[model samples]
Target chain A: MPEHESPIVTVDIVLLTLEDEQLKVTLMERTKEPFAGRLALPGGYVHTNTDQNGDDAARRIMTTKLGFAPSHMEQLETISGPTRDPRGWSVSIVYVALISREALASHSAIPLHLYPVAALPELAFDHNKIVRRAVERLRSKGTYSTLPCHLLPARFSIPQMHHVFELVLGVPLNRTSFTRKVSEMGILELAGKEPAAGRGRTAAQYRLKEEVSFFHRPLGDGM
Target chain B: MPEHESPIVTVDIVLLTLEDEQLKVTLMERTKEPFAGRLALPGGYVHTNTDQNGDDAARRIMTTKLGFAPSHMEQLETISGPTRDPRGWSVSIVYVALISREALASHSAIPLHLYPVAALPELAFDHNKIVRRAVERLRSKGTYSTLPCHLLPARFSIPQMHHVFELVLGVPLNRTSFTRKVSEMGILELAGKEPAAGRGRTAAQYRLKEEVSFFHRPLGDGM
Candidate 1:
């Protein structure tokens, strides 16, 4: 196939985080003609000259547009069709990244806005569908992996971790049951620290085990 | 970007099935250059003229190349980079499909070969990596969904179903435990039929319930 006849390939990232107990995704206002002044996920065309792969392009886009690197990133899905982009057929290798809200606070070079995943406004292109897919991936994987930990600091209390899980899953879990399940996963270790001041009794802090990628076993009920 | 300078986009499918209690995948010998006369997954360039999206391209590829349509198909991953394809920068939207051995037996227009997933020979391009990703997706999803049913006929006995799951999961599940788990999922309905001619007493047959997409809850422990 001739180059122009082929679809244009790009990378759009769904950068997710927890803000005030609500799941939010990063969005930016477009400054180009295709969707000038409209809100869209931060993305750009693949730089074949410099990028080694789509993953590289996604990381570069995150750094240059969002001003920080995500601690956890994975290929979410690829959205493509003839009607996705007005210019022509376009294929976007969408990636999902999880980061702490504090990570974004220190790097605010770009004028990006964080909107709750459920209450997102009209976005450019087919980004709304992309964000929905990312959220589904996160919530489903949250049951089996240490995914919610990406939204927390290095060390956190069991109660704090439980709250994060509840927020992502949208279902309140029994306190005793949640803690026991986390303990059984064997992916977390005691950090030898106490919760920060000002909240009732000080709860012992825990951190993810070093070099652990994900839990070897399922964390919760499979669904 | 000029037409000639852009990367080419294509779709490749990892079609999987079970044969003789072993997991097998379909491969075809490439007739064109790049990797002529070598074993590769049945795939081709995206047909922008007719295909509305990658999903359509994948289905078309299956019909034309494999001479059969898969029962289940989903977007697996998009493999992209300058190094993936030898003919310059190319992006392949990989899809995972599940079919039954009987389906392939009925449609034999194309000369395709079935190879065990574990003992695959040197394949053309980066197809080995694509096949590996498909297997991982299948095995992980097998824990929560009725995925192995795609490898069986419409109606089958419990023992036959168990064998299919064992082949895909590579683990022997206790008959009692597996039956209990399947009953709890409520996705299968008794078909009011007896097993086909066999060596022993006739067993009750079951089929997947109509309009069932996936289980509402997880099915079993993660592998």
Candidate 2:
């Protein structure tokens, strides 16, 4: 392909967070064509002159568009095609970013627009397809990893973690097994104690040992 | 970026298969400038006009370069940088493909130059780093999924599947436990009995119901 017809390459990020027990993705109105003024994932053309690589492009986009970095980010898949972007053939190295509600709230002044994953407005380009793949990755990884933990506060009680799993997996887990399984993974450490809940009962708070962890066993079994 | 400064975009594939119980990756002698005589992963510039998407580009390359299509292929990740290719900025959608030794033997006329992954030559560009990530993914997925089974013949004995896991994960697993776990996953069906071993006892051959299946539990616990 000639220089003028070089595949229009870019990077797009699906920044996801849980708001009031509902999973949401941040979107912004496109500031330029091919869909100016329409909602789309935060993204831009790769700065071949400045950006070192795809990861750098993702970090730069997050900083410039979202105002805050996600605690957890991963390359979900690269979305490419002739029709994805109206400007000739284009490619987007799509990524998924996870922010806890607490983390998201800390930057509330940015006025980020979030829409539920289950019910998204028709987004610009192939963004809706990109978001679905991101969710699929989240759900698939959630079955055996502490990935959803990124959806909770930096410090959270056991029940808070349990509730997030149920919300994301759409299945109720027995509380005792959930606690034991998480404990066995050894990905969490006791951080402190939560202020008393109803009935004046205090719950223990914990912090993840890492950004994410995959369990030896899927949470679906024996839960 | 100006038309003349457009980034060079391409796709590279890391085609891996097992040979004599050893993990090997396919490479071809580079036929172009920058690394004309060096062996590198089979790759080419993406046909922006003819290829519809990344997957399509991958397929076209497989057919044109290898002549035989792989039974298992996936988008591992996209690698990009200014210096990866001598020709300006470039992006390559790296893919990993798995082929059974049996399948590869059938296409012996292709004269493929496969190198053991454990001991690789100095590959062109960042191809070595790309190979390392592909191996990492294969190892991680081997722990919980029947991914390594792709290294076996389409119809294989139970012990053949178990040995491939051991080779890929670099861990020995108890036979009874491996059998029980695989049975529970329900991803394989008995195809036929293998020719009798030295003891004059035939072993059952099984065919994977799908290309791969993840077990609810890792093959790490219990005998």
- The per-model lDDT (C-alpha) reads 0.79, 0.80
Q: Write the per-residue lDDT of candidate 2 for residues A115-192, one digit (tens) a residue.
A: 999999889997887787788778877767877888888898888899998888878989999988898878898899
Candidate 1 lDDT tens digits, B1-223: 4333567788898888888878899998999888999899988887666777777788788888877667577787787778778887888888887778887777657766899999999899889878877887788878667777788887888888888888898888899989998899898888876745777656788888886643221111130
What RMSD, rounded to one decimal, does every model reach? 5.6, 6.4
Highest lDDT model number: 2
Chain B structural similarity as TM-score, candidate 2: 0.89
Flag regions of model 1 displaced more than 4 Å: A2-4, A107-111, A195-201, A211-223, B1-4, B107-111, B195-201, B214-223
Tell me how candidate 2 scores on lDDT. Answer: 0.80
Query: TM for chain B in all models?
Result: 0.88, 0.89
* Residue B98 alpha-carbon offset, candidate 2, angstroms: 0.7
Name the lDDT of candidate 1.
0.79
Docking class of 2: acceptable
Write one digit per residue (lDDT tens) for candidate 1, span A159-221: 889999999989888999888888888988888766467876566988888876532211111
